[model samples]
Each structure stands twice: as structure tokens, then as C-alpha cells.
Target: MSSAGHLYLHTPFCGSRCGYCAFTVEVGVLDRRDAYTDALLAELAVEGERMGTLRTIYVGGGTPSLMGPERIARLLDALRPRCADDVEISMEANPETVDERSLAAYREAGITRVSLGVQSFQAGMLRVLDRQAGPEQAVAAVDAARGAGFESISVDLMFGVPGQTDELLDADLARALEMGVDHISWYELEIKPRTALERAGAALPDEDWAADAYERIVGSLEGAGYRWYETANFARPGHECRHSLGYWSADDYVGLGVGAVSTVNGRRWRNHAGVDAYIGTLSSGVPPTRSVEHLDEPTRRRERWMLALRRDEPMDMRWAGPPDHPEALERLVEGGLIDVDADHIALTRRGRFVQNAILRQLMEYA
Candidate 1:
């Protein structure tokens, strides 16, 4: 089998957990930074054998920027030799955790792209989300990433937030547009189970209102010359996030660090989610503990269809395999929900708005 070309390194350190976050994260582990980096390197040494020339490397969080440039540089230095010449290296940073000098250092260390976690621009909304960074800090972080000479700078925003009104969302959009960032990941806030938001019974905006907000977000970004390349992602013509595209395109990828998940050669595994366990096992010269699953052909095929439909492009039917309900395709087309060509099928603009519902009628999910 061909080696995987995408890599995702998870850094689980966070100063404090967010109200909406449920990611594998370790808070108050500042002292474990060095050990964590060591663990990641050790894991990479083993996993790297399965990786091909890396096309994309994504350093995601609990706030990867909190690891500081030195740790990141060491990780990249080790990864550089295995990377393609034009590999895209991206890292996610919380605005409160980055600055101009640190961002420059991160750039010098080999990160080509930086995605700032600017969840919202309103102070009340930031508080509701329990974000540490203020509006100005998010702006400064973007400016810093730009000044640091990053090839691309992206920001994350949220809609459907508990207190997010259209005016507030418009303001946030205006701020993002004003900054002229290269990309934006505007996601709806979901009150996931066990999250602080869910526990506190925080309610989201009405579904109809959220739908309108999503439309507005898509329209504003597209109007500003950005492409709605994916469901929740907008970018300038060539600044689309290649790392994320790799995932949507169903490319094999290797993931490193505690709680990181990898799928390669039909086998998927997730490393155990304890930092101590990860570090100790790697230090003992053994692979970290993990839960492994072998994906079946039907599972993979269904996933390919689901992921491909999320993009604003045609899904090659030959590659994706037949849908569970081929008859539904004709019905969907009649309803203007999808466009089907001889060998490919794609969602219409209206269909994209209810992608999940379409997927449900077209396929089965456990």
C-alpha cells in the first residue's frame, strides 16, 4: 500500500478548557511541555516509517502555540527531512498565546501557515465561550501572523452562539474582512455532551436563525472575493487549507501525540489519551497504547461519499461507489438538491444547506 502523505500532530496542552471544548486536552501541564515534545518525537520516529513524503502537516490543539516556538521547531526539524519540498505546515494558535515576536519565531521555525482561534469578536460572546483573548488580541494575533511572513493566515469564528445576534455576527464578519486574512473557518457552536455549555444548559440560537446566519456568512465571505471551498471554510483563490483538503479527499494520514487518531492502509488507530501514559510508554522504547479499528470497504466508501459531498465539487461516482439508495439520487435531483452528471454527483447550493439530511437519505451511518 502507498504511504500516507498527511500528518496531524496534536498538542493537548491548554491553559484552561473552553466551555464548548471537548477535545483531548490537558490543562495545567506546563511542566510537561518538554516531556510531551519528547513523546511526540518518539511517536513520530515510529510512525514516520509509514508516512510518505509529507504533503501537509497540521499542528492542532489544545493550543499548539502554547508549546512555544522551541518545541515546535524541534518537531518541524525532525519532520522536515521527510516532507515534500513544498509541504504545507500549519499550526493552530490561540490569540492569547501568541505575539509578534513569538509568531516570527514560529515562522522562522518552519510553520508556513497559522490559524488563530479567534472564536468571536464580541466581548460578551468571547465571555460566553470562555475565551481568554479579547477582540483586540485576536486582531493583533492576525497582524502578527501576517507580519511574521506566514504564507497564509487563517482565523476561526463561531456562529449560532448563545448570544450571537445578526448584528454581532455581521460585526465579526466585518472585522474578519477588514483584517483581510487569507482564510476563515466559521463554524456553528454546538453544545456537545459534557461540555461546560451543555452542563450549564446554554441554549443555541434557533435553528432557523442559525440557518440564516450561515447563509449570511457564506454570502459575505463570497462577496469579499473569498471562495466557499468547504462547508465552513472560506479562502482566497490559492490560500485554501491543503491539510484539511487532504482529509476531505479521503487521503491516508498519520497522526501523532496523545489522543491523536490515524488512518492508514485501511487501519485506523487512536493513541491513548493520557499524557503520562504516552510519555512513559515512548520513553520505555515502546509504542504508545492505542485503540485500533480496521475499516471495512462499506465504511470507507460511505465516508468517502459523506466527506466529498461537503466540498463544493463533484464527487466521482466510480471512486465513491454507489450510494445506499440510488433511487434517492433521482428524487434529490428532481428536488434540485443535487446535480448528477454521467459519472459524478454534486450537491446543489440548496442541498449543501442540508448536507447531513441528504446524506441520511443517501446512506446509512452507525
Candidate 2:
């Protein structure tokens, strides 16, 4: 029995790929979109027959906005029965692809939240990232989406690019606030392997510099009335992404489509990475899973601690257990990576900067 409450659908097509992105995305002929949607729905049906009702569904993509209304409607139609009432449906969009009609169609199809990829307000920065949207187009997309009755809109911003200055970043932040989005995901630019940035030898700012930029970003958004709920994501009081919160909180989720990873119950599985392989597998009326791992009890407990540490909330000390290295937690406590209370251990604001180190310490100790 699947019985998962979270659903994630990955739409893998983009008009063009971003420079710093390494996700399993494809830029292909528009003619292939309909077939892609059909295959996605087929995957969803197979998963739904097992997973039952989902309380939240996130439709993320290379650019979901590029899909037409009918395609989106058809996909959602397949998803409707598997979803519970008050399902927090979310979709990631490209500012260049969303229009009034598309926004309306998404709202009508039960997408409650729209996250626009507006990496930077500066046209130069956008070009550096190979982004297709201009400042005007970004503004227009937000206006159109709000006009289409999407109350909870989110925008993504990037920092620490090759030539991004603090002044330019401040301008971008101000522009984002002026756009009136309820949520803002301010991400530092990281050059991952195989991405355009990595190939172009794009130099990322130093870790200290990135951390400083993040601090300033937090200050600016909070000053503008957004709450810093997670490390990269911020929102107005109740507008925090329920789906993402579920991710960091170690809740169960079902991920569908090529290259998607799902964690249901205690088992982790990933679908086939190649689109062709995924489609061929689905054509045989079988789930296109590529690999599966049933995590051991120790692995699960360790993962729970690591996942909980991502949140602003304290980690449960019960899971902390006896450290593999007796002095690890004590050293982190002294170094200020984490703080211990009566029943929980939590990262300090400074600790969040070097979260990987703290988690490594815990895992190494384990």
C-alpha cells in the first residue's frame, strides 16, 4: 500500500536551459510536449492507483508555463481524484512563458501557487545566466498571474554571479518586493557539473562572500515584510511552501516522471533518467523506476536528523542518540554549529551557514 500524502510531478522540458542548472531537464521541439504530457499522466495514474490521496502536489519543471492550457488541464484531470480537498498545488514557471490565458488556465486547473523564475532584475545578469526573460516581461508575467487570480505567487532570485554587485543585488531585491510576491526564493549561484556555467568557467564568489550576501538578502526581505522561514526560501507569515516544508521535514512523497526521486514510507526510489527510456518503459504498462533502496533503520534515523536540521525548528534529541564520536556534538556546541536545549538540538543562524559541516559531523559521529 503506497498511502503517501505528497505528490511531485517533474515536467522536464524547457524552451532553453539555464546556465547554472543541472536538473534532468531537456530543451526540445515544442511538438513533443503533448506526448510528454500524456506519458506523464500515465505515470501519475500508475502511482496514484497505489498512493491514494495526496494532500499536496508540486508540479515543478524546466518550465511548466510553456505547456498549453489543454495539456495542463488534461494532466490535472488525471490528478484530481488522487488529490484531497485543500490540496496545495504548486507549479514552477518561466517569466517569459506565462501569459494571462496560461495563468487563468492554471488557476482553473487547481494550481494554487505559481513560482516564477526571475533570477535577476538586471538584463545583464539575466544574459549572463542565459535567461530569456527581460525585466518588463517578468513584471508582465507577475501582473498577468495576479490578474488571473493567483493570490500566492512566488519569485526566485539568484545572487553571487560572475559580475553581480551588491548594489545590483539590492536593486533586484527591491524590484522583487515591488512585484508583490508572497514568497521569495533567494538562492546563491553554485556552479554544478555539466551546466553552462561550469563549462564557461564562471567564477562563483567565495563562501564568506556568499554568506554575507545571504545575510543581506535575509535582512532586505524581512525589512520588506517577508519571513525567513527556510535557508533559501522566505514568505509572508503563512505563505511558506507546504510542499518544500514537507521535503525538509522528512515527510513521505511520491515523485513521478523522468529522473524524479520519491520517498514513500521508508523506501527511496528514482525513475528512469532518460526520457526515451522512461517512455519506453511506460509503453509496456510498467512503472519506469530505475532503482530502489530500502533504507536501514540506522540510515533512516540519521536521515531524520539531517533532514530536521534543514528546518528552522530544533532537531529531536532522541534521534541524536549516542554520538559516533563522543566529542563531536560537544565540539559543534563549542563552535556554535548547533545549540542544545532540554529536548532538542537546533542550528544557530551562523550554524545554518555551514550546515553541511554540522550534518557531516553528526553522520561521521554516527
Candidate 3:
């Protein structure tokens, strides 16, 4: 079971592209989804040999739910050999693609968790983001997921979106909490180059406003009994995402699909982003990897620190510590940015806000 670890499969088909998305997703390619899935399965069959005892599986997307429930069942069936007896199977779905039947089929096929992408409930914000699903559909998807007997349900919300005000964000968060979901992934809207958001010609808020929004989100979520387990994630007590925690803990995981990234045993690789190339390579029994990385000890430790700090996990000073800025580290500790003791150093609540700055110092000084 320990050897099995984690698996992340990226399903890359979407009905319509969002303004802010930078993912490798196929639009109007639903007709070719099955071919993509076939190639995905072929790759999985090869990878499955090595992950015969998987503990966690995350099916992220373009939109996994768009694959239809029957296809989803087939994907699960292909992975059953690798799945652990007690596994946490998580799938990302959008509101429009979900229904009672699909949710029920997903539950029947061993999907234990559903993460619905409900970017915003505000009508205006949804329009600005180019999201097809309405606020009511978002609520209904959660209800159907819960009714289908999923062990846990998570909702994704976007902050820093154009036309999003604090009141609107508050309303979105309130609706999420009202649904009684177990987990939430709240992320700021990042405008990538060549994205529709950039072409939309709206200036984003400055860093100060973004920080203020983060503070409000943290306050609201923590007040509602949710643990800010990761920089952008919250959950009730035990509902934290197991797959993500694995990465933060420096455990090895495999990513299977077009545009997927896999890191295992200090070696990392990424698959080709183009769908045709991905399918062609796998169909011919060749790996679709476009690049590979070898993470040496120092690199791994640095990566671990960066990942762990975001989760507020304690780091052992013996193996991981600020080696360079002895004076700066002390200054930060004195300034209440971090909490330190003999064995471990952790970010205090105040420190979480300046995590990026601290992380940069830790890496640069070393």
C-alpha cells in the first residue's frame, strides 16, 4: 500500500473554454473523447504495472464529467488493479455536465469524492468568466453528488475575477458553506499569456487588493470551522485532499494522460500537450513524455520545503531549514512571521500571507 501511493489522471475535454484557463484542454473535441480515453487507457495499462496498490487517485480535467458516466466507469475499471482496497477516488466535474444519473453512476463505479467547479454563483461574475453553468445548477450538482452517496464533496471558487467584489465573493463563499460540502479549493484568477482573460482587456486588481481578498477568504473559512490546510484549500477536520497532501509530503505519484506530469523516485517527466501526438505516441507503445527532470537531494529538499510550507506543515530543522539567512531567519521569527523551536519551524497565521517572500528568501539564500 505504501508503495502504491498516488495517481493523477488529466482528462482534457471541455464544452467551452473559460476566459482565465491556461490548461491543455480540447474544445469542441467531445467527438474524439473516446479515442483520447483509449489512448489514456493504453498509457494507464503500462503505468498500472508499477502502481498496483494505489491509495489515492485524482481525475482532474478539461472536465472529467464531460467524458460521460459510462466512459468514467471504463476508466475506473482499467484502474481497479492499481486501486487499494481502501482508496480515495476523486474526480473533478463541472455543474453543467453533472446530473442525478451521472452522479449515481460515478458513485457506483467507486468514485468516493466529487469536486465541482462552481467558479462563482453571481450571475455577472459567471458571465465575465464565460462559465456556462448558472448558480442554481451549481447548487443542484452538489445536491445530486451528495444524494448519490459520495463520501465527500468539494467545491472550487475563483477569487480575483473581473467584476468580482468583496460582497459577491462573500456571497459565493456563503453559498458554498451552506451546501455543507466537506472541502473547498479557493484560488485567485491568474491571467496567463494568450488566455481569453488577457484578450478581454480588463485590468486586474493590484497585489494589495488580492492580499486583502485572501485575508477575507481565510477569515470566513476559518470562522466556518474549516481548516486552511493548504495555501488555497480548506476542509473540515479530516476532509483534506489526500492526493495533494501526498505531493506536499514528498511522496511519489504518477500522472497518466495527455499533458500530465509525473514525478517518481526523484525523477520527473511531462507528457506531450498536443492530443494527436499523445494518442499517436501511446498507440505505438511509446511514452508521450516531452521532457524529464532528475531531482537531486538539494532540489528535492527545496521542493519539499516549498510544497510543505504552503500546507503549514512543520519542517524538521535537521533535514530542512534556512541554511543561509541565519540573521534573517531569526528576524522573521522575532517578527512573528514564523514559529520556531528546537526541531521544527512552521509558518504562523500571520506568516502565511507572506509565504512567497519567505519561500524566495529560503531558496535564494541557500
Which candidate leads in TM-score? 1
Model 1 lDDT per residue over 22-126, tens place: 999999888999999998999988887899999999999889999999999999999999999999999999999998899999999999999999999899999
lDDT of 3 by residue, 1-366 (tens): 334479998999999899888898988878878888888889987776556478999999899999888888888898887678888999999999999888999889888999999988888999988899999999999999988888799999989987777788889878877888999999988889888889878777777888999999999899999999999999999899999898887788999898898887788888878888888888888778679989887787788788888886777867664444556778889888998888788999999999988877667524
lDDT of 2 by residue, 122-195 (tens): 99999999999998898998899999999899999899988888788889978988887999998888889999
Each model's lDDT comes to 0.94, 0.83, 0.86
Task: Give all TM-scores, in the order shown.
Answer: 0.99, 0.93, 0.95
Task: Tell me model 1's lDDT, rounded to 2 decimals.
Answer: 0.94
Answer with 1 or 2, whichever has the higher lDDT: 1
- Worst-scoring 10-residue span by lDDT in model 3: 319-328
Backbone clashes (count) for model 2: 1
Worst ten in a row by lDDT for model 2: 318-327
Candidate 3's TM-score? 0.95
RMSD after CA superposition, every candidate: 0.7, 2.0, 1.9
